[model samples]
Target: MFRSMLVAVDGSDIGQKALEQGLAVARAMEIPVHVVHVIQTAAYPALALSDLPPPDIAQQALLDALYREAEEILAGAERTAAAAGVPVTTHKQLGHPGAEIIALARKVGAGLIVVGSHGKGKLGRLFLGSTSSYVVDHATSTVMVVRCEPGAS
Candidate 1:
Protein backbone atom coordinates (compact mmCIF):
# COMPACT_ATOMS: atom_id res chain seq x y z
CA MET A 1 0.00 0.00 0.00
CA PHE A 2 3.04 2.24 0.01
CA ARG A 3 3.69 4.69 -2.81
CA SER A 4 7.42 4.55 -2.10
CA MET A 5 9.67 3.08 0.57
CA LEU A 6 12.52 4.78 2.37
CA VAL A 7 15.27 2.53 3.73
CA ALA A 8 17.61 4.02 6.33
CA VAL A 9 21.05 2.43 6.43
CA ASP A 10 23.76 3.32 8.92
CA GLY A 11 26.28 0.66 7.79
CA SER A 12 25.63 -1.57 10.75
CA ASP A 13 24.84 -5.27 10.32
CA ILE A 14 21.26 -4.63 11.38
CA GLY A 15 21.10 -1.72 8.99
CA GLN A 16 22.05 -4.15 6.21
CA LYS A 17 19.14 -6.34 7.25
CA ALA A 18 16.78 -3.40 7.03
CA LEU A 19 18.01 -2.57 3.56
CA GLU A 20 17.47 -6.12 2.32
CA GLN A 21 14.04 -6.29 3.88
CA GLY A 22 13.05 -2.93 2.43
CA LEU A 23 14.19 -3.95 -1.03
CA ALA A 24 12.19 -7.16 -0.84
CA VAL A 25 9.12 -5.21 0.14
CA ALA A 26 9.65 -2.73 -2.65
CA ARG A 27 10.04 -5.48 -5.20
CA ALA A 28 6.89 -7.17 -4.03
CA MET A 29 4.87 -3.99 -4.13
CA GLU A 30 6.43 -2.82 -7.39
CA ILE A 31 7.38 0.50 -5.81
CA PRO A 32 10.57 2.49 -5.96
CA VAL A 33 12.83 2.52 -2.90
CA HIS A 34 14.66 5.54 -1.53
CA VAL A 35 17.79 4.89 0.52
CA VAL A 36 19.08 7.50 2.93
CA HIS A 37 22.29 7.53 5.02
CA VAL A 38 22.40 10.30 7.57
CA ILE A 39 25.69 11.41 9.08
CA GLN A 40 24.73 12.15 12.67
CA THR A 41 26.96 15.00 13.67
CA ALA A 42 26.11 14.62 17.30
CA ALA A 43 27.46 11.09 17.34
CA TYR A 44 30.98 12.47 17.27
CA PRO A 45 31.62 14.72 20.26
CA ALA A 46 35.38 14.29 20.38
CA LEU A 47 35.81 16.40 17.30
CA ALA A 48 33.84 19.21 18.87
CA LEU A 49 36.41 19.59 21.57
CA SER A 50 39.65 18.66 19.83
CA ASP A 51 42.56 20.66 21.18
CA LEU A 52 45.15 19.32 18.78
CA PRO A 53 44.22 21.59 15.87
CA PRO A 54 41.80 24.34 14.84
CA PRO A 55 38.20 23.32 15.50
CA ASP A 56 37.24 24.02 11.90
CA ILE A 57 40.00 21.78 10.58
CA ALA A 58 39.13 18.93 12.90
CA GLN A 59 35.43 19.30 12.17
CA GLN A 60 36.01 19.29 8.46
CA ALA A 61 38.16 16.19 8.70
CA LEU A 62 35.46 14.35 10.60
CA LEU A 63 32.84 15.50 8.12
CA ASP A 64 34.92 14.24 5.23
CA ALA A 65 35.37 10.82 6.76
CA LEU A 66 31.67 10.57 7.60
CA TYR A 67 30.70 11.52 4.07
CA ARG A 68 32.98 8.89 2.61
CA GLU A 69 31.44 6.26 4.80
CA ALA A 70 27.96 7.48 3.90
CA GLU A 71 28.81 7.21 0.22
CA GLU A 72 29.90 3.62 0.65
CA ILE A 73 26.75 2.73 2.60
CA LEU A 74 24.47 4.30 0.00
CA ALA A 75 26.35 2.65 -2.84
CA GLY A 76 25.95 -0.76 -1.31
CA ALA A 77 22.23 -0.12 -0.82
CA GLU A 78 21.89 0.92 -4.44
CA ARG A 79 23.65 -2.18 -5.68
CA THR A 80 21.43 -4.37 -3.56
CA ALA A 81 18.30 -2.65 -4.84
CA ALA A 82 19.50 -2.99 -8.40
CA ALA A 83 20.10 -6.72 -8.04
CA ALA A 84 16.59 -7.02 -6.65
CA GLY A 85 15.31 -5.25 -9.77
CA VAL A 86 13.85 -2.48 -7.64
CA PRO A 87 14.13 1.17 -8.68
CA VAL A 88 16.02 3.21 -6.12
CA THR A 89 17.13 6.73 -5.17
CA THR A 90 19.67 7.56 -2.48
CA HIS A 91 20.10 10.56 -0.17
CA LYS A 92 23.10 11.65 1.89
CA GLN A 93 22.14 13.93 4.73
CA LEU A 94 24.05 15.69 7.52
CA GLY A 95 22.10 16.04 10.79
CA HIS A 96 20.27 13.99 13.35
CA PRO A 97 19.59 10.63 11.75
CA GLY A 98 16.02 10.32 12.95
CA ALA A 99 14.99 13.82 11.96
CA GLU A 100 16.69 13.66 8.59
CA ILE A 101 15.07 10.34 7.80
CA ILE A 102 11.61 11.58 8.73
CA ALA A 103 12.07 14.75 6.71
CA LEU A 104 13.24 12.85 3.66
CA ALA A 105 10.40 10.36 3.92
CA ARG A 106 7.92 13.22 3.95
CA LYS A 107 9.72 15.05 1.17
CA VAL A 108 9.73 11.95 -1.02
CA GLY A 109 6.20 10.98 -0.06
CA ALA A 110 7.42 7.64 1.18
CA GLY A 111 4.53 5.81 2.81
CA LEU A 112 6.82 3.29 4.43
CA ILE A 113 10.05 3.81 6.35
CA VAL A 114 12.33 0.87 7.07
CA VAL A 115 14.93 1.24 9.80
CA GLY A 116 17.02 -1.04 12.00
CA SER A 117 17.11 -1.23 15.77
CA HIS A 118 20.58 -1.31 17.30
CA GLY A 119 19.13 -3.30 20.18
CA LYS A 120 21.52 -1.42 22.36
CA GLY A 121 20.34 -2.43 25.82
CA LYS A 122 18.37 0.02 27.95
CA LEU A 123 21.57 1.39 29.41
CA GLY A 124 23.05 1.90 25.96
CA ARG A 125 19.87 3.55 24.73
CA LEU A 126 19.86 5.85 27.68
CA PHE A 127 23.34 7.09 26.89
CA LEU A 128 23.46 6.87 23.08
CA GLY A 129 19.79 7.14 22.14
CA SER A 130 18.24 4.96 19.47
CA THR A 131 17.63 6.12 15.93
CA SER A 132 15.03 3.46 15.15
CA SER A 133 13.05 4.32 18.26
CA TYR A 134 13.03 7.97 17.35
CA VAL A 135 11.88 7.26 13.81
CA VAL A 136 9.09 4.99 14.99
CA ASP A 137 7.86 7.57 17.45
CA HIS A 138 8.13 10.64 15.24
CA ALA A 139 7.42 9.44 11.73
CA THR A 140 3.98 10.09 10.26
CA SER A 141 4.21 7.12 7.90
CA THR A 142 4.41 3.42 8.57
CA VAL A 143 7.76 2.34 10.06
CA MET A 144 9.17 -1.16 10.05
CA VAL A 145 11.97 -1.66 12.56
CA VAL A 146 14.19 -4.61 11.79
CA ARG A 147 15.53 -6.05 14.99
CA CYS A 148 19.17 -7.04 15.21
CA GLU A 149 19.53 -10.79 15.11
CA PRO A 150 21.16 -12.29 18.15
CA GLY A 151 24.90 -12.81 17.49
CA ALA A 152 24.69 -11.10 14.12
CA SER A 153 27.53 -8.73 14.74
Candidate 2:
Protein backbone atom coordinates (compact mmCIF):
# COMPACT_ATOMS: atom_id res chain seq x y z
CA MET A 1 0.00 0.00 0.00
CA PHE A 2 3.09 2.28 0.20
CA ARG A 3 5.21 3.46 -2.67
CA SER A 4 8.25 4.60 -0.67
CA MET A 5 9.42 5.36 2.86
CA LEU A 6 11.24 8.34 4.38
CA VAL A 7 13.50 7.84 7.40
CA ALA A 8 15.05 10.68 9.42
CA VAL A 9 18.22 9.97 11.31
CA ASP A 10 20.21 12.16 13.70
CA GLY A 11 23.07 9.79 14.57
CA SER A 12 21.40 8.93 17.83
CA ASP A 13 20.80 5.36 18.99
CA ILE A 14 17.06 5.84 18.70
CA GLY A 15 17.60 7.23 15.24
CA GLN A 16 19.46 4.07 14.29
CA LYS A 17 16.57 2.01 15.55
CA ALA A 18 14.20 4.04 13.41
CA LEU A 19 16.41 3.39 10.40
CA GLU A 20 16.37 -0.33 11.07
CA GLN A 21 12.61 -0.36 11.49
CA GLY A 22 12.07 1.71 8.37
CA LEU A 23 14.36 -0.53 6.37
CA ALA A 24 12.52 -3.59 7.58
CA VAL A 25 9.25 -2.15 6.38
CA ALA A 26 10.77 -1.05 3.11
CA ARG A 27 12.21 -4.49 2.54
CA ALA A 28 8.92 -6.22 3.24
CA MET A 29 7.01 -3.79 1.07
CA GLU A 30 9.65 -3.83 -1.68
CA ILE A 31 10.00 -0.08 -1.80
CA PRO A 32 12.90 2.32 -1.80
CA VAL A 33 13.79 4.18 1.38
CA HIS A 34 14.82 7.81 1.47
CA VAL A 35 17.15 8.62 4.35
CA VAL A 36 17.65 12.22 5.47
CA HIS A 37 19.96 13.98 7.95
CA VAL A 38 19.04 17.60 8.46
CA ILE A 39 21.39 20.24 9.81
CA GLN A 40 19.29 22.61 11.90
CA THR A 41 20.67 25.83 10.55
CA ALA A 42 18.03 27.88 12.29
CA ALA A 43 19.67 27.21 15.60
CA TYR A 44 22.89 28.87 14.47
CA PRO A 45 21.31 32.28 14.29
CA ALA A 46 20.86 32.24 18.02
CA LEU A 47 24.63 32.38 18.41
CA ALA A 48 24.46 35.86 16.97
CA LEU A 49 22.62 37.07 20.05
CA SER A 50 25.61 36.44 22.30
CA ASP A 51 27.25 39.50 23.89
CA LEU A 52 30.23 39.05 21.61
CA PRO A 53 28.77 38.24 18.21
CA PRO A 54 30.25 35.16 16.66
CA PRO A 55 32.74 35.97 13.96
CA ASP A 56 31.99 34.89 10.42
CA ILE A 57 34.86 32.42 10.60
CA ALA A 58 33.41 30.84 13.71
CA GLN A 59 29.99 30.58 12.14
CA GLN A 60 31.45 29.01 9.03
CA ALA A 61 33.39 26.57 11.15
CA LEU A 62 30.23 25.47 12.93
CA LEU A 63 28.39 25.08 9.67
CA ASP A 64 31.27 23.08 8.21
CA ALA A 65 31.24 20.75 11.20
CA LEU A 66 27.49 20.27 10.87
CA TYR A 67 27.84 19.46 7.19
CA ARG A 68 30.54 16.93 7.93
CA GLU A 69 28.42 15.27 10.56
CA ALA A 70 25.48 15.13 8.20
CA GLU A 71 27.63 13.49 5.55
CA GLU A 72 28.79 10.85 7.97
CA ILE A 73 25.27 10.14 9.20
CA LEU A 74 23.84 9.82 5.69
CA ALA A 75 26.75 7.68 4.54
CA GLY A 76 26.28 5.34 7.47
CA ALA A 77 22.57 5.12 6.73
CA GLU A 78 23.33 4.26 3.11
CA ARG A 79 25.72 1.54 4.19
CA THR A 80 23.27 0.06 6.65
CA ALA A 81 20.47 -0.03 4.11
CA ALA A 82 22.75 -1.52 1.49
CA ALA A 83 23.77 -4.30 3.86
CA ALA A 84 20.12 -4.91 4.59
CA GLY A 85 19.46 -5.32 0.88
CA VAL A 86 17.06 -2.40 0.73
CA PRO A 87 17.16 0.24 -1.97
CA VAL A 88 17.92 3.64 -0.44
CA THR A 89 18.52 7.29 -1.23
CA THR A 90 20.18 9.78 1.11
CA HIS A 91 19.49 13.51 1.51
CA LYS A 92 21.45 16.17 3.39
CA GLN A 93 19.44 19.27 4.17
CA LEU A 94 19.84 22.51 6.13
CA GLY A 95 16.75 23.70 8.02
CA HIS A 96 14.50 22.79 10.90
CA PRO A 97 14.68 19.04 11.25
CA GLY A 98 10.94 18.48 11.34
CA ALA A 99 10.20 20.75 8.41
CA GLU A 100 12.99 19.36 6.26
CA ILE A 101 11.92 15.79 6.91
CA ILE A 102 8.28 16.46 6.06
CA ALA A 103 9.27 18.41 2.98
CA LEU A 104 11.47 15.59 1.75
CA ALA A 105 8.66 13.11 2.30
CA ARG A 106 6.32 15.24 0.26
CA LYS A 107 8.90 15.81 -2.45
CA VAL A 108 9.50 12.08 -2.76
CA GLY A 109 5.81 11.28 -2.36
CA ALA A 110 6.74 8.85 0.35
CA GLY A 111 3.82 6.97 1.83
CA LEU A 112 5.44 6.66 5.25
CA ILE A 113 7.70 8.88 7.36
CA VAL A 114 9.77 7.28 10.10
CA VAL A 115 11.36 9.27 12.93
CA GLY A 116 12.96 8.52 16.28
CA SER A 117 11.36 9.81 19.45
CA HIS A 118 13.69 11.93 21.59
CA GLY A 119 12.16 10.32 24.70
CA LYS A 120 13.12 13.40 26.64
CA GLY A 121 10.07 13.10 28.91
CA LYS A 122 7.30 15.68 29.30
CA LEU A 123 9.44 18.38 30.91
CA GLY A 124 12.09 17.99 28.29
CA ARG A 125 9.62 18.07 25.47
CA LEU A 126 7.97 21.03 27.07
CA PHE A 127 11.24 22.94 27.26
CA LEU A 128 12.70 21.72 23.99
CA GLY A 129 10.07 20.72 21.46
CA SER A 130 10.39 17.25 19.97
CA THR A 131 11.05 16.95 16.26
CA SER A 132 9.21 13.65 15.95
CA SER A 133 6.23 15.16 17.68
CA TYR A 134 6.34 18.09 15.30
CA VAL A 135 6.44 15.80 12.27
CA VAL A 136 3.59 13.72 13.62
CA ASP A 137 1.55 16.80 14.18
CA HIS A 138 2.25 18.37 10.78
CA ALA A 139 3.07 15.74 8.20
CA THR A 140 0.34 14.66 5.80
CA SER A 141 1.85 11.21 5.31
CA THR A 142 1.80 8.26 7.67
CA VAL A 143 4.38 8.68 10.47
CA MET A 144 6.04 6.06 12.63
CA VAL A 145 7.71 7.31 15.79
CA VAL A 146 10.25 4.86 17.15
CA ARG A 147 10.54 5.40 20.86
CA CYS A 148 13.91 5.32 22.54
CA GLU A 149 14.40 2.36 24.83
CA PRO A 150 14.54 3.15 28.52
CA GLY A 151 18.12 3.18 29.93
CA ALA A 152 19.41 2.96 26.39
CA SER A 153 21.15 6.15 25.42
Q: Which candidate is the best by lDDT?
A: 2
TM-score of each: 0.89, 0.91
Residue 117 miss distance in model 2 (angstroms): 0.6
Flag clash pairs in model 2.
Answer: none
Candidate 1: misplaced stretches above 4 Å? Answer: 45-55
lDDT per residue (tens digit) for residues 16-134 in model 2 = 99999999999999998999999886677754344645547877788788889999999999889989999798999878899999999999999999999968887988988889989
Worst 10 residues of 1 by lDDT: 46-55
Q: After superposing candidate 2, which stretches have Cα over 4 Å from the reference?
A: 46-55
lDDT of candidate 1 at residue 122, scale 0 to 100: 82
Clashes of each: 0, 0
Per-residue C-alpha lDDT of model 1 across residues 1-153, encoded as one tens digit per residue? 889999999888899899999898888899988999998867787543435365577668878888899999999988888888887899999778999999999999999999999788789888989998899999999999999877665
* lDDT (C-alpha) at residue 33 in model 1: 88
Error of 1 at 108 (Å): 0.4
Every candidate's lDDT:
0.89, 0.90
